[model samples]
Target: MIISSAEIDSAVVALAPVMRRTPVVASRVLSEQLSADVWLKCENLQRTGSFKPRGAYLRISRLDDEQRSRGVVAASAGNHAQGVAWSATQLGIASRVYMPVGASIPKISATRSYGAEVILQGETVDEALTAAHAHAEESGAVLIHPFDHPDIVAGQATVGTEIIEQVPDVDAIVVPLGGGGLLAGIAAAAAVHRPDTRVIGVQAAGAAAWPGSLQAGEPTPVGTMDTMADGIAVARPGAVPFAHVSELVDDVVTVSEEAISTALLLMVERAKLVVEPAGAAAVAAVMSGQVDVSGRVCVVLSGGNIDPLLLTHVTTHGLSAAGRYLTVTATISDSPGGLMEFLALLRDLGASVVDVTHSRVAGSLRLGEVQVTVSAETRGPDHQSEVREALAQAGFLRS
Candidate 1:
């Protein structure tokens, strides 16, 4: 079914009272870095820490009493489940969410807190979806898809409405793509309101389908998924979203794991906003030089429900990418004097030791030799080089 501007506008109007009109934040750092006017659509701060609530609420509110009484069931990796659960609770409807066993703890807990019966099943979203669909059929529960629905596309289009009003004369918009609900909806609205503005979709490099699928003139599943952006890690694009995206989206770009992690860190440290790897993929494309932006650009921060453990790793990875964190292994004499010398060398190079481990029996170290693996905080990449040089001068072999 085709999604029109009127339907999208009505959805926005319907959701106005329930969903937040999240902030459009200007980032000087990102603007200077990208050499373009940069404003972030911070939907990461939306009601369910995601823009999913807009579509979920709009979809749920439209259900008739009979359908609502039957309740709703959905499958999700995390964010969509929370969106559906929260929207159902707001509508006073019974809801059950099927999520992958590997879903983040924060998302699982949050969905349960929203008053939805949570069911953990399978290892991946596709598996959970299979189980959810079967359960829905058996229990007569309404199945609410995470994406690929007309109401959902219409609901997601509201984001474009807000963006046009919030950032007039926007030259381009970059959205992270999964099943393409958000991209399709935004593209449709942008085509109507800002036809000249370029709309680009960003996907995880490991899970990208837009480029190949558009070329093939049909949905084509990726061979494998490898990136950290689980939210956009769809093997294949949705039929409904793909139809709109093929026409309205200008370009589709892919970003790497490193770029996504860096973007997430930048959101937290530089922009003071928390964004998940999936939500930060658009920014990742820009930061990784995968996309060119010469004019005013808006990057949508789609969600912010990253696992705490993953957040720690992303922070370290990002810092390492920016040359702010350094890890090195040095082999020295097994004697206690070797550690003293290594510490002195690091201090001389102005490296602050964050973590250090010494092993004498793990490998082929000589009877008097030791392996010291050290993680240090450095001023920059130059300081890291200085530390390496100092260690070498102190008779420590780089491992």
Candidate 2:
């Protein structure tokens, strides 16, 4: 189904009072790094901690009275589950949400908190979706897909309308792509209102299907996906959204896992924004130079509903990627003060020790020799190198 700008405008008007008008701010750090005017559409601050609510609410609101009475069912990794649950509650309708078993704990709890029946099934979203479909068919509930539907696309297009109004001269807009509803909606809106604005879609390298699908001239499912950006780890693009993307979107690119974590870290430290790995995909593309940012660019931070444990892991990985965190296991004498001497060397090299462990019974160690494992926070790659060099000079060989 073709969703026009008028439909999006109507969705904007219908959702005006329901949804928050998420802010757009200039990213001075990103601007300087990319040598372009960089802006961030902070959808991470949107209701339900994502832009998903806009689409979710709109789709549910359009349902007939019977459908509303029958309730709604949805499948999601996290953000969409929360959105659907929140929307159903707001509309005074029952909701059943099917989420992947590995979905974030916070999201699952949040969805249940919103008064939805949360069912954890399958290891991936595709599997969860299958379960959701079966439930909908059995229970006579209206299945509200995360993407694919025309109403969902029209609702998501509201973001583009807001962007056009906020950034009148936006030369390029970068968005993270999952099943492609958000990208398709924004691109369609841009095609109508700001034809000159380049609409770019970003996907995690591990889960990217658009590049191959586009090349094949059809929607193609990936056999395997391995990425921390679970929000965008869709195996295939939705048929409805793919039609819009093929015609309206300017380009699609993929970013590495390292880049996604780095972008997430940068947002926390530099922008003071809590963004999920999937939400940071556009920024990751910019940081990795995978997208053209040589113009007035706006990168959408799609959601912030990340689990605390995952956030910790991503932050640590990001620090390691930036060369600001180092872990080394070195051979040291089992004699007293051996561990202390190794720590002293690290301190002298200006590396702050975060953790230290000594193992005397390691197979790699000789008699009276122990292995000292140390994790430290350094300034950067250079500081890490200096610390390693200092350790080597102190007769400590890294294992």
Candidate 3:
């Protein structure tokens, strides 16, 4: 099933009224940092808070009357669940979504809000897929795969069409790869409209399966999948989308967990955009210097369906990774005003104390000494170093 430009055009027409024509905006900060013309395709702002609906809606729309009557079942980590649920509701079809037990709370609630029966099963998407398949078999419902289908790929190809229309001279397009539907779709469309535009795919390093699978010329599954970018934590690439990716995608790359977290923070702090970890993979690749961004590059911010709790963690991790947050343990006098003096030193050094813990009965503490653990916020690495130096010079021994 070759996905052609015409098919993508039809998808665009089909989804025009439903899907948001997400904007393409220039990233001044990224452009200056990478020395490239950086543009962001903000599908993070898309309906259902991700680009999944483009494919989900189109796939469901193509279903025959009998299939629609029987309804549809799907498995996803989060975004796809909401997409399927929302699309199914719009089409007046009953939908059941099997989500990983560890799926984000917000996503689970959002899926149910869309009027789908949400079942929490398994720890990963693959496990949930097993349960979804069983449900489809038992209930005689049509299974709507998150990826792995020609229709899904064709629907996702509409994103590529929009990119070309928005940035005609685009030199490259970077997309986050899960089961490869988005990458395959964009690559295929680029082949027709902008053949010279390089199509790059990014994946979380912990759960990346594409590099190994591409090497073996087959869908190879990773032994263990773990990453904050749950949206792209697929252990294996979809067979159908992999075929398209193998032929059309120019390159595939992986970013570290740290990079993913830092990228999410950068998007929020710098771009003022709330993006999920998986949705920040393209930007992460660029920020980590894993990809060549020397030309007119467009990074797809795929989704914005992150839980608040995860966002807080990512923000803290990002700050620590950037050297703006510091933690240190030191010995101070157990006498009253001893702690005050130490805090005064930190204040004089221009560091804001975030947390403090003191213990006088620790094994390492002397009779008149106390162990103090301080968590402080600094301006950056240089400021953190200054604070550490001040402590050392003030006769405060770091433990």
How would you encode candidate 3's per-residue C-alpha lDDT over 1-399 as one tens digit per residue? 568777888888999999899999999999999999999999999989999999999999999999999999999988999999999999999999999998999999999999899999998999999999999999999999999998899889989999999999999999999999999999989999999999999999999999999999989998998899999999899998999998889999999988988888889999999999999999999999999998899999999999999999998988888888899999998898999999999998989999999887889777899999999999999998888988998888653
Task: Sort every candidate by TM-score, greatest first.
Answer: 2, 3, 1
Better of 1 and 3 by lDDT: 3
Best by lDDT: 2
Q: What digit string (tens of lDDT, one per residue) describes model 2 on residues 313-351?
A: 999999999999999989988888887887888888899
Predicted candidate 1 versus true structure: per-residue lDDT over 1-399, tens digit per residue? 568778977988899999899889898989999889999999999998999998898899999999999999999999999999999999999999999898898999999999999999987777898899999999999999888898999889999989999998999999999989999999988988899989999999888877899999988887777778888888788899988998889999998887888888889998999889999999998888887788999999999999989999989998888787988888888775778888888887888889999888867677888888999889888888887877777678644
Candidate 2 achieves a global lDDT of: 0.94
Q: Go through the candidates in order and give each one's C-alpha lDDT.
A: 0.89, 0.94, 0.93
Clashing pairs in 2: none
| Candidate 2: regions farther than 4 A off | none
TM values, all candidates: 0.97, 0.98, 0.97
Report the Cα lDDT for candidate 1: 0.89
lDDT of 3 at 60: 97
Candidate 3 residue runs with Cα over 4 Å from true position:
none
| Candidate 3 Cα lDDT to native | 0.93
Off by over 4 Å in 1: none
